[model samples]
Target: MKETELRYVLALLRVQGIGDIFAKKLIQHCGGAEAVFTADAAILHRIDGIGEIAIQRLKAPAVLEKADAELEYIRKHNIKVLYYQDDDYPERLKHCIDGPVLLFTAGKISFPEQKIISIVGTRQVTPYGTEFCKKLIADLAPLNPVIVSGFAYGVDIVAHQAAMEHQLQTIGVLAHGLNQTYPPAHRKYCPKMEENGGFVTEFWSSSNPDKENFVKRNRIVAGMSEATIVIESAGKGGSLITAGMANDYNRDVFAVPGRVTDKYSQGCNNLIKTQKANVLTDAADLVYMLNWDLAAEKCKPVQKQLFVALEEEEEKVYQYLNSKGKEVIDRIALECNLPIYKVASLLLKMELKGVIRPLPGKLFEAV
Candidate 1:
């Protein structure tokens, strides 16, 4: 957004009583952020949920002063601002009712039809969790997913490092402003992450990484992604909060299942028991659940080979594919009397075994 328009929007948000949802309503009703302040009190009073107090707050001069100061900080630091109504805003987040009206971003961040997933868990990550988190990113590397995390220690940092190791774009969503890093130690990763992906936050330059800010920040981590994956968590933690937000947003959630006795596994187990998330064993579960276009971006299947062994279901799928010559996934599922998800998993396994190959438009054929 231009400086003049950004100043008005910032001022509108600076008003005490106006939240994101109401700010959006006000902007739409008044035609623009500048119009919201310039429109008559009588005009503003006509809109539903716009009380007299809010109208008066919009007229306050101090809000504009604050906005001007913030605008200066933005200009001085060269920060990129994403307006909610603009085409450049995070598309998934735009659907959220509480998404920020303006997002301050740093680094080379772009979201254009990319598969994004958030990996979150307890800050006190264990060896098992670390192993699973790293392997998951590495396995999914072939599809080139954007790995997003809070940029904290443990699972968050582990996910970021793994994504970098694989040379995939990785984003760190900050709970505080772009002016500083929270943990301080993570400052090292910022430069490298900015080269491909970068940091995002709704907080202003003056805002600090307070306790309450994290709870609010969880929504962004969940909102911007296609799915949220919990690598490991205790019975209660911030990861669960993000997972709940993901569920509320109607986005997919996945949890790595571990032993019932494991301390960090308790939260994931509970999530699965309550049917809040799918069981994520590996990348195949994600590929199946999201129904990603495997043919377009998936890892290449092994070269065709003879005498490859197949499981019972795999053999069944192979026979059907061989007889049909080529068939779409849904038709294969219907003919085989298997669930679509099961069929998808089986096809992936067959592809790995050199028995089948995936074609465009979800078509599959025996090799």
Candidate 2:
């Protein structure tokens, strides 16, 4: 949390071709980035991956200026910076192979001892996929677990929204800087998240939301979370990257099953069939697998109520609401493949019973 430490760390990270792994090695060998900067070239080269080019880059005035700019930006925004050695640095992420040497954060950060789950999927999620995400988040909320996601469209947006609705802390690992939210459409929700959870990034404020950054961001999300839940993904999607990273991090990976024909579900189904991920039918399976006692206690009683009163259709709707969080009537109908009028009437009845609450814009939250 020291400003000096943050400045030095950002300087080291700015060195060309010196990524998290190399940066960590440099830090460990030299004691810190400050030491690395002042260390002899011969000693710097002795560290793994610290070749002459990287060493030369570290010594460049331009590189120093960039690092100083990053530090200034952090100061301007009052961003909380955590070096890997800091106690507040996420232990789970630290254990990962390529964890960041420095993290830039905004808003409150909660490092829960409970299970952490990363929900990920395609940005263009299907209606069914969105519904599933909402329900899953609602079910997991009472356990007070930390939810992690990329804050992209589709499943990611739904997961964050659901967590917010339930007053649960959620972290969005950005591919860009904390200076701006990607896709601009997410600006409104970003402030909401700042008030409750937080935003985290490895990139400096001036860094662009480049393609490679997202791939790198996936590792942080997977590394920090105890498990990764892929709500709906295509064969080639960023969610797969997070799932792969989770596997690499030796964390449990779960995927919701969808109809075989569902393009969004194909990646999830493929992951299960390939034994890359466990097939999750509902929140219970996830909770059991994680050995989440807190979530189990809250879920068991609700399971009974869910089973006793819910008809097949109502159960499906409820489950959708629970997973996807609050959703519009049109979306629910499209997801459930039911008539809009029928879905609306059912939602009204559920709303009256305190099972869900209707929000503005026809959005409904599971109560």
lDDT of 1 at 254: 100
Identify the candidate with maximal TM-score: 1
Number of colliding residue pairs in each model: 0, 10
Record all residue pairs in model 1 with backbone atoms less than 3 Å apart, i.e. clashing: none
TM-score of 2: 0.80
In angstroms, what RMSD does candidate 1 have relative to the true structure? Answer: 3.1
For candidate 2, the per-residue lDDT at 82 reads: 77
| lDDT of each residue in 62-151, candidate 1, tens digit only | 999999999999999999999999999999999999999999999888987879999999999999999999988877776788999999
Q: Cα lDDT for residue 357, model 2? A: 60
TM-score of each: 0.90, 0.80
> What TM-score does candidate 1 get on C-alpha atoms?
0.90
Model 2: lowest-lDDT 10 consecutive positions: 295-304
Query: Residue 211: error of model 2 in Å?
Result: 1.7
The model with the greatest lDDT is 1
